[model samples]
Target: MDRITVLLADDNLIVRSGVRALLSRDEGLEVVGEAGDLESLIALAEELAPQVIVTDIRMPPTFNDEGIEGAKIVRKRSPGTGVVVLSQYDDPEYAVGLLTEGASGYAYLLKERIGDGGQLSRAIREVAGGGSMLDPEIVSALVSPAKDSSGLNAEQQRLLLQVGEGKAVKAIAAVTGQTPGAVDRAIGELFLVLARDASVGGKDALRRLRSLHTAILEREEQGETLSRMLPSKLAAKLRADPTASSRTERLTVTVVMSDVRGYSGIAERSDPGALAQQLNAHRQQMNAAVLSEDGTVMQYVGDAVMAVFGAPDPQPDHAERAVRTSLRMHELQRALDAEWQKEGLEPFGMGIGLSTGLVAAALLGSAERVEYTLVGDTVNLSQRLQDLARPAGTTVASESTVTAAGDRWQWEALGDHLVKGRDTPVAAYRLTTDTTRTEPTPSREEATR
Candidate 1:
């Protein structure tokens, strides 16, 4: 790690020297310049171009908001320079005001707490690395009065506070007993929600969001994109119950099982490169369709895509959503197949199954590779129904799914068939509506495009 260049600014000479002495003690920090007033601070910032500027919240002739004004000017002039504001009071408004331009590369700490362990050093390091931190005293003061007004529950507020205090994703996860991926997803969602609030100030919200995004993206020491593994809602659930992770709950949900028909034959006959491309495109289309309807993709096993609607986060219309997703998936596959054919590639045919009933859902396996698993008749029956779609491009649903989905679809009763797992026969329904209508998607290409 390169040493962080620091510039100290304060009206009092004693305070400036003390800060410089404290920060210089760390080999990672280098005190390059000092300023006693706002004018000098701005001049030295331009002259030295320090990586970080540690200054009092109020200073100079007026002693009003010169520190903040100077910091903003410095930020505008030097794009990546971090500003650390030291205040004598516990007011959250000062910290709030400092973050008006943007949240990236900023920190606010009470001057009295500078001697409390390594608070000053931590703030400097956090701000230097494009992270924001607020004093705990300031956060506590703000969280209490706005709890009921903002509609944020206790957990959300706690998470927000942790973010504001400059805790890294893994740090927050450790404190909350949640996975780091879950914390990263929750923070992104929280900031977007907060950014839309008229009272929160859009610029400030965006700043917080931008800073958080930067922090989370760089949290992994090995530079891994860890947060992309799970659905946002699933990650939120992981954060919601970090302690009760492995507990199973009997919940009613809509399960979707899909597989590429004749995948074995296609893989054996087609070129390796072409088959890989086709499978990749198929998965992308399927994932888009499932996520568009707020469904969590359970996993992709070979050419099979399994998705679930409802569990990890409750959706009242899980069955309906599942049906809609199945329809969309079929349509999306058609569009992808058309494109693939135009490029002289083999087309993929998919068979889907939907079943709505009670299933036991739980966070299973271990932390290294945690997974959301569903077990019960619903899951088994759904797989059986998928196998029943012999000709492909068709979605078969269970009777319970048809009932829960109401009269939304033109259902063709497939009658009763004995599923592999059960002794008794199960009545099934096939969605007779044309699945290849080609629903207009927002974009022509995937993210990799």
Candidate 2:
């Protein structure tokens, strides 16, 4: 990694030398220039355009707030440059003034705490990465009184302090040992609580909260987009290393495919709005079932849903998980159908299939659009197996899946049959939805799409 180039600005020659010495100890940081006054600071900032600026709160030739004012001017000239204001004063107003415009790449640290065990180095690195940091003392001084007036408990007040310090939701989640989604919901609830409590400066608090929240979200949007498109675990991996998905890898996995039975006829007979609602409800139920089993829902092609287990993150019990998810999908849809029937909506019957084998999986597409997809016979066989599944709410598995699942569920053999896109017959098994119901022979028409 390249070292973080920094420009140091302080009126005191001893202070500037000490700060430079501190930064020099870390090979990852380099002091590019030194400025002792507002005019020289602004001049060097424009000339050097360093990644970060470490400046004292007061400088020469009118020593009141020149550090902050000059830093602001540098940032305005080069929006990408980060500023860390080192202040001997822990007054909340200084911190607020430094961050009033925005807090994306800013830091406020007490000069007293600068010598405390790599704290200054960490702050410099953080701001260099477009993340902000606040002195713990400053954060506490800023938000301590809001505890009672803001209607927040101890834990909520702690969370408020982290937010005020410009921590991202992901960072907050890491610190609190909670999921990002949970942290987001907590912050939203905190906002509601603050909005309800009428206290002095409540409006200012809300404005700052809104601004900080937006900055955190905007910083993590790539991860957020990946989360919506892929599994949470997979998204985090990609977020940490963007190149993780670039290469294809082969792994043992189970592919699942499900389709709404008689979907064409249902669509033809039902009203468009009602059918769309039912389809939306059906997809939601399917998503919930798959996610509960830790499966990745790949796509929804009209009435068909495709899912995979094992790739992106390996799971040894992938076959069992896929089978369990398929059963759960059927059960959930049955319950949803019962409710839809009461509203005079046609019920949707589902046929699902599972196949287990080694397949190549990778995230593919251009910069504009991409998808995590599985390749090989396993994916194709799952679709073919779904077509062979007879009756509603039935799940069919290939011989490989049945073997991999290892007698977890009693299976009824569906005699070897020639499937489309294959020369030889593929053996299949059904996890009997109804014990008494006999197997129906698949006709030539049923075998084709």
Alpha-carbon local distance difference test for all models: 0.76, 0.81
Prediction RMSDs, each to the true structure: 16.8, 20.6
Provide the TM-score for each candidate, comma-separated: 0.51, 0.52
Q: Which digits, one per residue and each the tens of the lDDT, describe model 1 over residues 1-449?
A: 34667889999889988887887678888887889888999999986667789999778779898998999999987656888999997866677677665566778889999878899898887777566667778666554343333745677778877765546788888988999889878876766666565464644555644544454344332122122345546655655666546678888999999998888898888986456546755776788899898888888888999999988777889998998999899899989889878878777898999999888887666556656688888988899999887678989998888778766466767779998979999887777766433443222112114
The candidate scoring highest on lDDT is 2
Tell me the TM-score of model 2: 0.52
Give every collision pair in model 2. none
Worst 10 residues of 2 by lDDT: 436-445
lDDT value, candidate 2, whole model: 0.81
| Residue runs of model 2 more than 4 Å from their true location after superposition | 1-228, 433-449
lDDT of 1 at 423: 96
